[model samples]
Target: MNTTITSNGLPVLPQAKGNQNAQAQASQPATEAAPAAKADDSVKLTESARALTAAQGDKAPAIDTKRVEQIRAAIADGSYRVDAGKIADGLISMEGQLNGKP
Candidate 1:
């Protein structure tokens, strides 16, 4: 009886002549496969992202006075508490959604 051992100490079955030939063919370089094609279009940025990049190092647009007053009132009345965990979770969720994995 013939016996074979693998690198991991596992017992290997002896291959028949036809099985060996098949394995050799399988191991040969696959000439039929073609290289991946390059993308024709360049990657695109969102309109908002492009605008933000264009506005980099410039002063941001002025906020509306009514909106600012409302925010100030909310903060003064203790109704504007910051939830760090919620903000973090929201940012993480938004990132996952943007990455197309959500």
Candidate 2:
């Protein structure tokens, strides 16, 4: 009598096995590393980004002081019409946009 082993019963190829082991190792968290230092670095990077943005300066034209004073006076006299609902809606929309919501 003769017996033969099947190909499916054989072990996985060395390269394929190595790749699988590498992927499993990569999935594990590097918890032993200093997380506090990483958090501090993130904070510093955010501050640097803010400083760069501020250094770019404003792109739009400056508001006229005379017009601003006129508008303030009108509001103080209760003559300027204000839409509270529109302001609220605008603020809500802005908040959603800032939070990355559609």
Candidate 3:
């Protein structure tokens, strides 16, 4: 078997003649002998996947637009306050949650 080096510098061994013929036949246009070959292909979604697909059509998650606008206005007016203690506490809480703590 002749070995070929791909662009990624990996060696690829030649396929068997029988396997090559089978692959070539599969790639060819549908013939009278294989009319149902492509038609038989199927996909089945899991329950969670179906639920996610159904949820995609529902209303989006809740967003506090009023609070967002207030924050934007404060930022534009140079009046937005940054509470370092609150930010630090939030980070610590997040770390605790990540570590499986209540």
Candidate 4:
């Protein structure tokens, strides 16, 4: 049996071919088999996966352009007033949501 030294300098132990095995396998020369063909590699997505990919591609932006334009116009006309109480309420609600509270 041939032994090869590993990276840590320890010799690799050969697999035990016990005498209990059938004689035919033992008599045969140990030859390497051909590796699998790389060109045959292929991908197959399920119907749900394809639908999900299409749905992701078809997604719309979360920001509403019309509302944004309105807000921008209000700010430019000096009519945009900051409601501190409303902003504080929104922040508290957000904190509650983040902390998993109702």
Candidate 5:
């Protein structure tokens, strides 16, 4: 009978003395495998941030798609005219708004 100690220092099952292969196989390490656990994810938001996100759902988009389409069509049809006075006034108005002059 052939007997050997396992990795845990416990006596394992005996094999026939003629089987040198069996002794070698038993001495080799046995890989221990465990099942993987599912991963968990979490997110936290401040009260104001949560309210803003919720409110955004009901608000209109910053850029109107319909207006964009109209502008694109006008440009394609050669009807979109650029007014220097209007642009200059708009720039002045923007500057005033930026300076908080209303």
Candidate 6:
């Protein structure tokens, strides 16, 4: 049997006469037949995943709100200072780590 694709990219298959009649009968269900039951979906977590979730609990990582407020206040008063040397050192450290250096 040959398969053809339409302009819309859907695969079109040549159906047999018996198959077409069966599909039509299936489309129009019997009046005595009951409706299909709804299925309940659920997620099953691995042992390691469940353990990690239990360890973390419901709380998120703690943030230094006081330090954040202090930084905001400093910026507002034009007293905030940027340590270029410290930033450069950190970048150099990251590069060294990425290169597999101690």
lDDT of 2 by residue, 7-32 (tens): 36454322222333545455443333
Q: Write the per-residue lDDT of candidate 4 for residues 35-60, one digit (tens) a residue.
A: 43354556799999888777888484
lDDT score at residue 77, model 4, on the 0-100 scale = 50
Report RMSD (Å) for each prediction in the order shown: 23.4, 23.9, 21.0, 25.8, 28.0, 22.3
lDDT of 5 by residue, 1-102 (tens): 966645585644433334347567766654432322223434599999888877898683587879977876655554556788999999999999999999
Question: Clashes in model 5: which pairs?
Answer: none
lDDT-better candidate, 1 vs 5: 5
Go through the candidates in order and give each one's C-alpha lDDT: 0.59, 0.56, 0.61, 0.61, 0.64, 0.61
Error of 3 at 20 (Å): 76
Give me the runs in candidate 4 sitting further than 4 Å from their true place.
1-62
Candidate 3 deviant stretches above 4 angstroms: 1-61
The CA lDDT at 82 in model 5 is 72
Clashing pairs in 2: none
Stretches of candidate 1 off by over 4 Å are 1-72
lDDT of 3 by residue, 1-102 (tens): 955333364433333234345545454443232122242456799999888877976565567979977886665554567889999999999999999998
Q: Pick out the ten consecutive residues of candidate 1 with the lowest summed lDDT.
A: 30-39
Residue lDDT tens for model 6, 1-102: 955333364434433234345545554434332222233534699999889877988764667979977876665554567889999999999999999997
Model 1, position 61: C-alpha lDDT score: 67
Clashing pairs in 6: none
Could you tell me which 10 consecutive residues in candidate 6 have the lowest summed lDDT? 29-38
Error of 5 at 89 (Å): 1.2
Off-target runs (Cα >4 Å) in candidate 5 are: 1-63
Question: Against the correct fold, how does model 1 do in TM-score?
Answer: 0.28
For TM-score, candidate 2 versus 3, the one ahead is: 3
